[model samples]
Target chain A: MEEQLIECDVLCVGGGIAGLMAAIRASELGANVVVAEKGNPHYSGCGRRGNDHFETWIPEVHGADKEKFIDELLKTAKGEILIGRDILRAQFGKAHEIVELWDEWGIPMRQKGKWEFAGHAFPGRMMTHIKYEGRFQKTVLVQQARKRGARIMDRIMVDELLRDGDRVIGAVGVHTREDTVFVFQAKAVILGTGKCSRLYQGLTPGMMFNDGHGGVQTGDGRAMAYRAGAELMNVEMPQRHIGPKYFAKFGQATWVGVLRDAEGKPVGPFVSEPDRRYGDIVMEVNKLAPEQYGERGRGPVYMDCTGISDKDAAYMRHWHIHEGNVSLVDHMDAEGIDPRKHPIEFSTYPLRGGGLIVANEKAETSLPGLYAAGDEAMGDISAAATFGWISGDTAVAYARTVEHGDVEVTRPIIAALESRIDELRGRGNGPDWEEANIALQQVMTDYAGKVRNEARLLQGLAHLRRLRQKVDTELMARNQHELGRCLEVHNLFDVGELTFHAALDRRESRGLHNRPDYPFKNPLLSQAHIVRMEGDRPVTDWRSY
Target chain B: MPPIINPDLCIKCDRCVNICTEDVFFGSKKHETPVITYPRECVHFNGCVDVCPVPGAIWLRYPMPSMIVYRTSSDYRAPPG
Candidate 1:
């Protein structure tokens, strides 16, 4: 056995698109950087299976005017999360700069005039490379970081940050395969570990098995940041999108493009019509075609691509050939029809996008030298591609500002981390991280889901509230690997409170934060509901975008 | 064109919705399954089948010789005369 000592100026915790961008930015600024990803950099993270298309808040993509996009986002924000006009506008304006950053890293963006794509009202302003595998984007970004002298440590489960006083100086993580623990020292520590969508019960069916299995997200950044006295935001309200209703169905990505009427019938001109927000039509579809929709059998309309051309089948075949997403392909085969020759059926289920975490423009936390990125960082950019890029860029910029100055780190903080690590190691070697993690998912799924009322939300909040406390006191990890999972669940318990609280504060329905009790979008609640753990009691405030 | 499908290999994940530069596929509604509405928009790039987590779920049939000849640009150009 050999000990490897690696040092850097900036340490990135996750290697998704956001982490990669941050690493690139820091490296360019002449900083020695190290990125530790919990999973394989190539096969894991949202960047692995998603389109390379970038969604910008620019008017070219939204419409001839920028106000509509801003308004649409404010509408989506729906009273929770920060919607500051300047902040939102600034995030949008940086889209090109972020794209240029990607371009500098050798990830070529397709430049097509009058571009047309799926899932947008206007032509795509996104620079997309369509003819290649989705992972190609990640592969290229990782390669760029490697070229820039950024060290990448893959499959290392980061358990906690190594703190000195209130400042985050480094991280302590373990290699999952070899079970080797390493303390990574740096001038700045950035949290880019995506989100915990998998923790929200049955909503994450296919995603339940991947390493953290939706368990890793639970706001690891948020929990750690809060413990360090950083301000958290919108902890009460988590966002859910329309998802698949079947067992472990993972193909919700393709169906997001389908548009239909209340009767589950094809809308307008089928293939040629421009894409628009069909969410409003969900209620109508439920009314007209309940039998076809799902268990509730509301307006279960789907896309009718029975007239697919041969060329189109070849295009879709590439995904099945490469990624092996057989849900659609197998259904087509069973029906004895081809997607190129016949239309495939489509529908929606409820999918939570995880709540947003708040941070300043520099990706700085209330606690200094601690930064947040990816799904855990907030402002108006949690789930979108543009926001992820911006977060990464912002975090890297702040990391550059960090200097190993004459300022001394307090001894108390270092002692605290060491004591906590020792205490965690001393606990009973019994709790299965996977089982507890799955239990957390079931709890969130059953109670705090798409149709949240006071009863279910309260019940979920109460149980998760208590569950978090018990896990902290009773649960113990036998090794560093299990400890990583334990920390993830603990973070989930903290962030889950944010989701529940936000849902309770805003007594109205808007965008993804839908409420069956308060079914209509309430204009009175249009003001953003800002919640932060101000001195124990979850304090709530209001602001406008 | 022959149809293609491979089922035992399908997990039905939604990577296709996240990709598809052309917005060719739409997600399913509550009761019904998802559908691919715009086959014409497909550029035959193979991103969908290639990105599927399961290998054999997507089936591919070759373009027939006659059908290929009919849709070719050369065949359409001469007919304008």
Candidate 2:
């Protein structure tokens, strides 16, 4: 029953790429920042492992004009970006400075005195990506934050936000390993807990919860924001991703270069094939994979690297050292699966969808004193960095204006959170976190998957409601780690239900949500469905950019 | 499948135990190698391998699913290595 109280000006939760960047920025701006992460900050969250490509604006390399970039984005970027223009503009303006700061921090993405860009130059670069060895990006960012005097409290998972009236003041969490409770009272809170977990068991008749994206990203931030009455955007867009079937970790950009079918036949005319957007391997694979790829009857797919010259192979190998999941190379080597000698196998993994917090250019959620970053802000890495930076600036400024004490607001919230933990610890036998997690994933994939219908969505919605009951009353955790997972599963279920409701609300098929029931886009429902909590239930408000 | 620790080379430094964010291995004892209790829980990020000071002290064994390049025998267009 150890209780710990941390007071800071800015509290950055999640500690992934965006959270770390936010911490560094906030701390640099003279805020006493504290980062509360569920896992080790260096190797946690979606961006923990590493990334090889950073999507940015390298104008010199790929003629950068704001209008043309936004125009091309509507043309090529993934999914329907109805309200992401301002976010894109924010990222575009800050790309050069962010890269420069990153370079100064040691991982010089740009080559000396030049912007060496790679990937996606069709029509003109869509400000999509540039190849870099950013394996140590998270670690370096963590170091920078510490150097600027930000205290990183790893292994604490923030479960709920502390609010006063409509504004969020702080958060409450528990230790993932020990019996410790953390009460973080901050002037401004940055909910950079990344996006939802890789929850949807992709294209399978049964549930396969193997597709986890880095350290458990189960939409804790978005869920917390929702419960706190913060408006959430894009809750229904099921974030589909095609990845290596078995080794299903998240960021595998540029890893699988050229994919060939099971018959040694190349999946030609790939968008990557023409543009060399090596990062689009997944999208290309998805476009080319046979109709029923992951099903038992379907043929296997492979990444064929046999045609690559010896010189290029060595060069590729060298580049991987700087990227995250460098461990994959070790895994491949240990398995004796050579990309050159043996065609590397791959398949798909799917998350139910992104339930992103509705954030402005400054990363402010609808709720005051609360901000969202990372994919929770729903932009690429450059946007993540940019949003993280700007949110820090805005949050620190907001924090400076607030009074120091909020004990009256935090006291009752802390008592409730403690009792909740005690209840979980006291429980003996009930469904474990895995059972509940798998059940929710099944529900999501079965009803609210890629293709959906009104009847199916309603059925899924009812099942989710029942499942939420089970998760609330019966879900038990043995120790701190299990408790952490239980908290994550709870958040995932909440986010899943939000997505289901959003799916049910949106009658027509648009973007990632496909409703064969209503074949075409409904002009009436063209705007983004912004979901917010109204007196305990989520209500959707249609908002146009 | 799971990481096989070479006891001979393992000085029991506890780097793997401390670094694994997944909680894959049980917490370590002083001078005792950590137990890989939750082997099935290994998501296979290989933070342990990356942080291991001793070379080849820890290595991963990918499960059979990764090796299954061909889902069925009839589809023999590209055979497994």
Candidate 3:
């Protein structure tokens, strides 16, 4: 048996957009960096999946209409779309800089007519080339990182962040294939681990290979920060989206056209139009009145593609070409009615968005020398794609501010990481990571999902509290791989509990933080709720957004 | 027609619910499988078939006339301005 250890100025966990972007920036700043990716870095996370719409085609087609298209985002986030406006503008302003970086690294982005070739609007299609896809983009970035003298380890899972006193030094993770645990020492650690969707039940579109597809973001990075004593914000404001469930299997269909409710009733503009935004086509069914849909009570709204113009229908068929344009035909066959003739049945449910982490515009977590990026850290930045890129840039800039050469700040942290690795090795079979992981996922999906009440939140919080106690005691992992899973479960518990506590404390609904018991948005509670680990207990505070 | 469903083998992603044009299928955001609504409206585009990641969750059946009927703009239109 051999023990493996590595050293770098900065160690980034996860290889999604944030991690790759961070690695590149760190290398440019002249630091030894390493990235450990649990899966192939090139693939898209929840971000890149489905049509590549928002940041892609919409911008090209609309141009100044960008404001109008982005209006959907603002509306989705309940009119606070500009919450991360500063961060988004910064990210978009540097779009060309990022593209240049990608170009210099040999990654091909469509500059000419790739989007037109794909039948999308022309203006919105800049940087629209379908190179090896988002995952391949990660692959290319990782390769570029290697060229710049950064080391990369695949299939390595970071189980826990190594801490010394109040500051985080590094992390201890397990290398699956080798079945051995290793420690990495660093002056700074960047967590870009992405979202935790598998925490919920329904299938999310991207990265089934990773833990949370789109349901419950595992909240691994947040947990690590909390355990090491860092502040967290808005963990309870889960971004629940109502997506076309059938899109995953049947290729995408034109949903906006054939809107309907759960009982197969038509609740069109023929009913309530003023109260809802967009056409009745885009409004959620719950937003419509019962009389509008003719009775069985509205469960969800469906898009009736049958009523859309032929041109619109064709556009939809072309848009969903990835799944072979089977959706149009599926609509025809399943209902035995021509989509050219009838409206489709549809419903609305919940989808978890990139949960927000309460950091200032700079992507800095509450911890010193540690920054959170990507889905791992939640907040206003989570909603906007452009803002996500900006958060990455901000994190990189902040990381550069720290001079890694100053051992006075980083050396002890690295040493502490080594010690933590020894602690895991000593505590053999301490906890069952997989079961605990499932339990946490259930807690998030069942209680914290879509419709939430104080009772459910309290119940989930209590369960998380118990899980926290058991995580260090009853859970046991057979090997290093299992050990990482155990850590992920522990992390989810920590994150879920924080989210529940925040949800409970908020006492009112606003944006994604919906408490059914307090459905209406209370201006009194419009401020953001903040929490951080103070010793063994989590401390809470409030800040105006 | 019992209306098309292969319960044992549904990945339950609910792509069918999104694609259905006749208001025939629905599912919960949290549920694994979708519920068939207005089974009569299903036109059997067979789109749900290939789109389904799982092999055999949906069963295509004959369209029922009792369901609401719709016409595309290409077929129905105002005379002229």
Candidate 4:
């Protein structure tokens, strides 16, 4: 297998929403952009399933409440969502511009030329989650990027970033279906590879391919950035989201109905309004509410939409574009169970790996030539898109001032990465990706799951260290696809260890990082964990964001 | 239950094989229909059904646990929005 060296001005490691936005903006700015996508650009990343709404602050709906919008993000998401004011401001400031761009790119954001508002209450509403049919967001973004002359290389699973001294020159990737390795050499690198949830999921034989929001989110981009001498923040906490059973799905219709206990009592808010952070309803339900339920009842909660109008029921059914397993609608329809008539069972699972790592308004990472956007860096779809938009300009400007790294500097980095890939190939029998992945998941779940203490976390770290040794020496991949899985599992190990350490360092419980030893949120430790490698060793330090 | 590919209706277009969002099926060179090699991996997004020219060629049968048939009262309308 020959190594292909592709040179570009800016290399985007993912082709998800952020990557496409970065590429679209960079290419539009006349920078030669190359997006290395692990899956088909038309159907990869988080927005691959499409979303019902993009969480942008719309002025028409909220009366342009900037402080209210920023406050809602920092507070309403269950806890203090340590997001930078700059990132939130960047997203809010350019909200209309991005919406217009999305509308122009054929994503129908407006219905009869008006954004349909949901979730937020009317009078003094702070947030406006605009509704749109986001099923083809990727396809539309891909079409736009291609039209702008940005090359989107599909099935290229980017394994690692290529560092030239302190700056990220480019990245190393493998063809998911072929033996070829793509070594991209660019003046600047922008990572938009979304969040990491599959580490907790990949081993589930039933869920071999899906995450709650994205397809194949293994924290690969985060791992790549960390390994390339970059700092990762807010990753100490992974999130738990509430949704339907069986499928890993979220949003869309899940939040529409009222939650009921077994006794036909309203367990959760009606979500008619003031229902920002609806998970708070579930948590409240899980407690001893004797006055509400007449007894201590917790177990299973059902979402009852029987009271909503036919219009709203139809709206929910219409919103079922399978970002929330759209096929469930067919199942419901076949079973003669209209959700407006039938109460759907709902449960909460570890939804998001919490932490809005640092990528300021300019979309710059700690490293000079690298930018992090979307889930890989910080913020939601809007922030990811906004930073991705900013990354285009920042990455382009940075790319213009520098030349590609000299061949001598890149030669060894490529060689080291190639040797590791070679070692993963053609091994007949050893710990396959599933085996290693399951082992890692077991350790993570046992030690670092909802409840965490020092002893268990320390033990988990030791177990991960042993597992890394086992995977490093005895891991096997039968094919290129298996090879990609193997690499993703390796990334899971890195990220899992990073999270375990981050969890260990943060002494108090806050949001998703629940340290049972120190149960309550500590004002002193109300800071974000920044994880970075200190020359062949990973280190985490609490920093004020 | 995962997505079952019905051989009787499959036209061997390879549409499901190439266009599956989750890559649940392997392209079957030996026959017209594709193989559900990664059946457990199927999240049942139904991209295969959307792409399949033939009706009933591809369909997702979710597990019984996933398909809870709890029917609420048809007349249970009290909480006004």
Candidate 5:
């Protein structure tokens, strides 16, 4: 196959909110930019479906005291992780401005004269969020980026970053449909591939059929960065939460409704309250669920929406439909269940790989000319937006200082990547990729998932290592779809191993990294677990917050 | 489930087929009218309806009770005091 090469001043990989923002900022700064997207920019990443609210510290609404706001934000991190204070300050400082930009783009930020906002209640006093009908957020961002003159290459999955010495020059990807290889040469590269969500069973058992994070997020950015010798943090701290069991779509309904026992008695405060983080709420419920729903007890835990007025329920349903889960209501109706009558059943699931690609306030990785943003760069959407904005300007500034280098230096790197793909294609058959993937998911879900102990983690790590060897040599793809799945499994192996090692390294129980053996948060061990590749092995280090 | 396409109203422009990430719509040829080949894959982000040039060419049959909810594209404004 022939190789296709494209040159630009900035190459933004993974065209989610962060990548699009980077491309838009770079283009606005008069830099030639190209966006390589695994899926269409119009509908990719978590932002594609839309979000209910935007979290920003609007001084006018909250306060002008920036120091106080940062302190409050740090409190939410809860000593378990070292959130870059500089990044948090940068995010809060620009919060209102970004919100204004969204509003100027004709995206609604308020339903009425008042902005309905609520904190998860880790610190309830800070109501720095505003509800919005953001179903068209991706469309709006794509339009803005295009208007700023950033060319978008859709369905191009970037598999590796091209480096000359220590600096990243560009990236190499494959066109899933055209069967062509794409080589993007640029002065700067931005990775905004979102988080790794399918590392465990997603939402429900069979519902794992599609990655809960829009079927595209696979820790591709983390995997690529690790291979390039970049540092990643908090690989073990998984985002676990409670949701409607089989019908995870109705999980968000918990935010608006009240939690109840099987007998329909109110059990606890609604999730919208500002007293505790949602994760803590899930932990509380998980303890009570088995006892309350056991055969000896009433039945099953549920989100009781019975009290929600018809008008409010209508509004909620409209919002849910646009979030790409309209099937939730349909499934309910098919089963003769009604939110107005029956309470939705609940279960717990892990959301994504923990604290990811470590970068500075400017979103620049340890490696020069390379930037990380979105879930790969930060933990939340608000921080992702801030990182995206900052990284775009940073990349543009860096581009101005450097000139485009020769593409010949990348030939060896391109050849190596292509050979790997060729080897996969040459393999006739062995263990099925899907079967191996299920085994991988089963190992993580059984051991490293919600529950964790030294013994279980070690056992999971051994199983994952065996699975990784099988995947590297035996996995095969006959078509474009299978090829995409094969690549995803390859990336998942990298993430799974890192997650297990990180889990084993952390000796104390922190916010999300709950180890029954440790059972307590140790002040001495309050540091971020940093992981990086040493040849083929991942080495762990700690950095104090 | 995928957004239901009204064959009568559809101009067969193939806008929905091109925009959907799930490849929900499939046909023998590019110009041929496409059918919803994989409804289960549709997350229903509703980008297809927004891009469709023809009005009423596609509509989602939401579950009952939710059927009463009205879908509109207008921005939320403050109600008259």
Candidate 6:
């Protein structure tokens, strides 16, 4: 396959919300921009399925001081992680801008009054969320970007970053179906690939193993950045959300209802606070379910939406469909399960990559010319939108200062990557990439999952190292799809290794990094665990929060 | 659970082939009709159907109760179980 060279003033990788926003912003800023997406931008990343609401801080809606909103945002970190204050402030400060942009793009945000908003998350009474039909979020974004003269290239799976000295110059990716390598040379590149959600066993079984976000989010952005010597923050702290045990295929069903026992009684006190962490909520349910409903029925816990009004139920159903899980309505109908009647069984699943790609207030990574946004930059949709906006302006400014310098794609780098792909294609017999991936997930889930200790993490790390060896030597891919899978597994291995090592290093129990041995959050360990490539190996260092 | 492509409706544009991140539609050669080679890999995000220029060319059947039951049973073991 011949290497195709493409050049742009700003190259936005992974055309999810962040990438799309960046491309739109950059192109609007008068920079030649190209967005290389693994899938169609209209239905890529978590936003492929629309979200229930956009969490924003409109002063009229929030009614809180900017400092209070920032405090609430930092509270979500649970004192376990050090979130960048500047980044948080920027995201909060720019929330109204994002909402305004979405409004202009014809995204239907449900506003109650001149200042009143609908669907705020928790704790705060100020309605921060403007309920929107987000099913066409990606499509709207693509349209907006295209209207502003941004080039959107789909089916380009970027696997490696091309760097000149310490600065990232471009990226190399395979055109999945065409079997062509795309070498995108750019003055600036923004990565918006979503989190690594498939490292553990997901709600689904078989080939589509991880179903929380989408099968496509394999932590490609984080892996590429890590390999390119960019620092990743909080890699050990995995975020999990509670959802229906059997309905993982239905996408995220907001935990709007109460947790009830088999006796049709509320299992726990319903805390409607905005600052309530989903993890804590899950923990509460886990503890209460087995105790109250263990002997009463077969199913342990259920999210009782029975108390919700018919109008609310209808709204929930509409939100579910709008979120791209159209089949969910059919599934619910066929099961004869009405939210107004029976409760739905609940379970927890991992959300995104544990740590995020470390970036400054401008969403620029430590490596020059490379920026991150969205889940890759470690925030919710509002944060991602804010960072995406900032990164675009930042990249455009950076591009103005620098020329499209000659990016020498060294023979050694090309040969090494090609050899790995060839080896997978050529192998006749070995462990199937899917089976290896399953094994990897099993190891991670068993030892390094939600419940963890130092010993188990060490064991998981050792097991992961062995699995990495198998993936490196015996992995096989007969076609382009399998080749993509092989690459995903390779990225997954890097993520797993980094996560395990980071977990091992963080002895105290903090936010999502639950440790049985260290049952309490250590004040000393409040710093961020920064992971970077030291030569061929990864090293972890702690920075003060 | 692969998507059921209506042969009668499909224009064979291979839009489904290009759009699927799961690569459920296996058609390597140009103009080759996309086949559901890896049925179980389909997560049913409906990207194929969404991208299909022909309306109703690709559709998905709701997964069977037994399949959902089995998956939930196997995948949802509580932590420390």
Q: What's the lDDT for all of these models?
A: 0.53, 0.74, 0.52, 0.73, 0.72, 0.74
Give candidate 2's TM-score: 0.91
Q: Which tens-of-lDDT digit does each residue in A453-520 have in candidate 2? A: 99999999999899989888888888887888888888888888888888888888886688998889
Q: Which window of 10 residues has the lowest lDDT sum in candidate 6 chain A?
A: A272-281
User: Which whole-number lDDT from 0 to 100 does residue A431 have in model 3?
Assistant: 48
TM-score (C-alpha, index-matched) for candidate 4: 0.90
Give one clash count per candidate, in the order shown: 93, 7, 75, 9, 1, 6
Candidate ordering by TM-score (highest first):
2, 4, 6, 5, 1, 3
* Model 3 root mean square deviation, Cα atoms: 11.2
Find the candidate with the highest DockQ and give its number: 2
Q: List iRMS for all predictions.
A: 15.3, 3.8, 13.6, 3.2, 8.1, 4.6
Candidate 5 chain A weakest ten by summed lDDT:
A272-281
For each candidate, report its DockQ versus the true two-chain complex. Answer: 0.03, 0.38, 0.06, 0.33, 0.10, 0.26
User: What ranking of all candidate models by DockQ puts the best one first?
Assistant: 2, 4, 6, 5, 3, 1
Return whichever of 2 and 5 wins on lDDT: 2
- lDDT of the structure predicted as candidate 1: 0.53
lDDT of 4 by residue, A406-465 (tens): 645777777876787888895778989878987887788878886789999999899999
Where is model 2 chain B poorest over a 10-residue stretch in terms of lDDT? Answer: B66-75
| Candidate 5 lDDT by residue in tens digits, A449-522 | 76699999999999889888888888887655456667877888888888999899998887667799999988
lDDT for A288 in candidate 5 is 35
- Higher-scoring candidate on DockQ, 2 or 6: 2
DockQ of candidate model 1: 0.03
State the lDDT at A134 in candidate 5. 73
Per-residue lDDT tens digits of candidate 1, residues A1-545?
12244567888888776677678777866778898887656544555543434445434545665556666655543234444575556566665456555555554443342333333232333321122134366777778889889898876666566666567777666664353556677778777777665556542343343221223445666666665566666555554433322322222333223344344344433234213222122322232232334556454344433344445445455444333244334444544555333333333333444454565555666566777766666422223334545544555565666655222243444445445555666886645555666667777767766678888889988888677766766777665545555666667666667677778877877755668888888786666566666667666677553
Worst 10 residues of 2 chain A by lDDT: A202-211
